[model samples]
Target: MSTPTRKPLDRHALWSLLSEKSDFWTEVNVVGVTGSTNADLAEAARHGAEEGRVLIAEEQSSGRGRLDRRWTSPARAGLTMSFLLRPTAPRETWGTLSLLTAVALEETLKAVCGLSAKLKWPNDVLLDGRKVCGILAQAEGGAVVMGAGLNVSLTEDELPVPEATSLLLAGATALDREVIAAEFLAHVGAVYQSWNERGPASVIERWQRNSATLGRHVAVSFPNGRSLSGRAVGIDADGRLQVAPDGAGAVETVAAGDVVHLRPRD
Candidate 1:
């Protein structure tokens, strides 16, 4: 398939969209260059950037993801931003925040682009069974900085991998990156507020509904040279994965790992 031509986004137009929805996003900071928005927000948190402050970058030289994987961000083809928050939850509940962000992304994509994006355990968003978005979270002191990258208009030739796709490539031709970003922040802010008011249980329930990993045979690779294979049941309140291993007597709760959803060998 040939790549579709896209219009260059103007910073002023982006600002106008954000400003129109100022109630949700108060402090919008845009930069032309940064190592990574997540890193920038972490530094700002160390020095105390206000809560609800958002940092966006047009290009990231060193974007990061889980397991120290490099998030390949090529110029303006993707949305790269980090949002700061100081939730009142205890330190142990911090891990659930990433899943909450994924839920928010899934909802926003469906509502905005009519694309039913699903969460692939942890924080990846997949469209048509291919990765289109990724989320990363960091905790500093008592605050959390959540970073998200979405491929808005990248073509198949520009995609980082064959298993990766963009909104434009997946039949969302009318979608705009700035519009998507603005709407996403609004939805995310609401989800964050819900988590603050209700609890992790509410967030987990919403996450499960949008999860693609649930009910799938999967393998989780741990850093300590241990691994587990099972069918993903669901996510618990503490954000641990509940997996039912094949021929197992009991379900296993996985706290952390890189989960790969597998198909039964034919």
Candidate 2:
């Protein structure tokens, strides 16, 4: 797809743009907060927030990522939101939800912003091989909340980490956050419904199509301080990373890790 060329949109304009989309009028709450949208959404869910409810924040003081890593938020430079979902499946299948979300996000970026994005394993979105978005999925009670942050207009100076990037830096301009949000909600809702009915195999198939990690040499680091370097074979049925060492016949299933796709050894 061609890179998007548009100007950054303001908050009010974002809401207006989303208002024109279908199914976006339901229980969507936009907040101008000094803290975290994920935390707020978790609290809302604990208080019995309805499924499909969305919480969006303009700025976050304590934004978070997977494994409790700190996520940076610059005023209005990115999209920060959390979606509530109540699926009927067993909780054991929750790991697949993140991969499903990644596919949904990839579709949204391609469809709405005219920019192609790829999934970097578990949940990060990469634009031209730089991190542009992150997804954090958490299960609480009977509901699952998926939080996402997409760098929309952030410049290099605004990036919290050197490995991060934004749509603007990736050659996308005039991509309105609200338009992107609306499109994301629509697509994610559809994907979630499909997952509820057909299970995660189909979603995993879609994820593999957009994945950039498969077939690449990678370094996988575990929380226990062990690390392994191997080639990413694919994702198994449960959304675990399947990796294999050189000349090894057995592939290892990695349930959780920090996966860094490595450059091929020369």
Candidate 3:
């Protein structure tokens, strides 16, 4: 296999592109490597870091997804980044941050890469039924840090799982990390501003429209060794996954879980 040319992100260039229109993204930090951008941002938020602070890493040594599941990608082969947010909305609506990021990612992929992506409830972004990105949001003090790991130039062998894919693998026209980063941040700022101004309904509507999970049969495994097999009915006001039980039961809302999309006959 031949080695692909992985371009390093130019923070200056990125800031210039973003600063022209985005009043939300105040700072951009690009590092060669880090244990986890999310960890870095979480610590910063606690220390009173301002909102709209973005931290991008070329590679993560200790990155994680929901439930602390390890998330890894080759150096400069993916978009591994996080941004801080402090919303004035009700605290209950804070849980929607990750979902909001997923929606923004879907828009970024479509507008920047020309690839139509779908949201797998909660935090995953899918392209052609394969996961292209994963998002995690952590709350610190009154701020929330949203992190995303997006596969960009990874080959099949570089994938962490068979179900995972990259922009290059997905046939994206644009492989420039700087371009994707700028476009993604812009989308995030715009979507977040809209959500804050118009309320959760704005983001929720977009999520449902681009969702790959809603109306699908799924099995959600919780940490307590219990699972719920149901059809994903909708997302509640708090961003919980509303699942209608298989046989007969109330539509249960799941705040956190491992969701597996089940086959039609399963």
Number of the predicted model whose lDDT against the real structure is largest: 3
- Report residue 58 deviation for candidate 1 (angstroms): 1.4
Cα distance off (Å), candidate 3, residue 259: 0.7
Candidate 3: lDDT over CA atoms? 0.92
The candidate with the higher TM-score, 2 or 3, is: 3
Q: Under the 3 Å rule for N, CA and C atoms, how many clashes does model 2 have?
A: 3
List TM-score per model, in order: 0.93, 0.90, 0.97
RMSD of 2: 3.5
Scored by CA lDDT, what does every candidate get?
A: 0.84, 0.82, 0.92
Model 2 pairs whose backbones collide:
6-173, 6-174, 7-174
| lDDT at residue 135 of model 2 (Cα atoms) | 95
Give, for candidate 1, the lowest lDDT window spanning 10 residues.
Answer: 2-11
Model 3 steric clash pairs: none
Supply candidate 1's per-residue lDDT for 238.
84
lDDT of 2 by residue, 167-264 (tens): 88887744678778878877788888888888898999999998899999999999999988889999888899999966656889999999998998
lDDT of 1 by residue, 140-188 (tens): 8878999998898788788878889998888873578788888788878
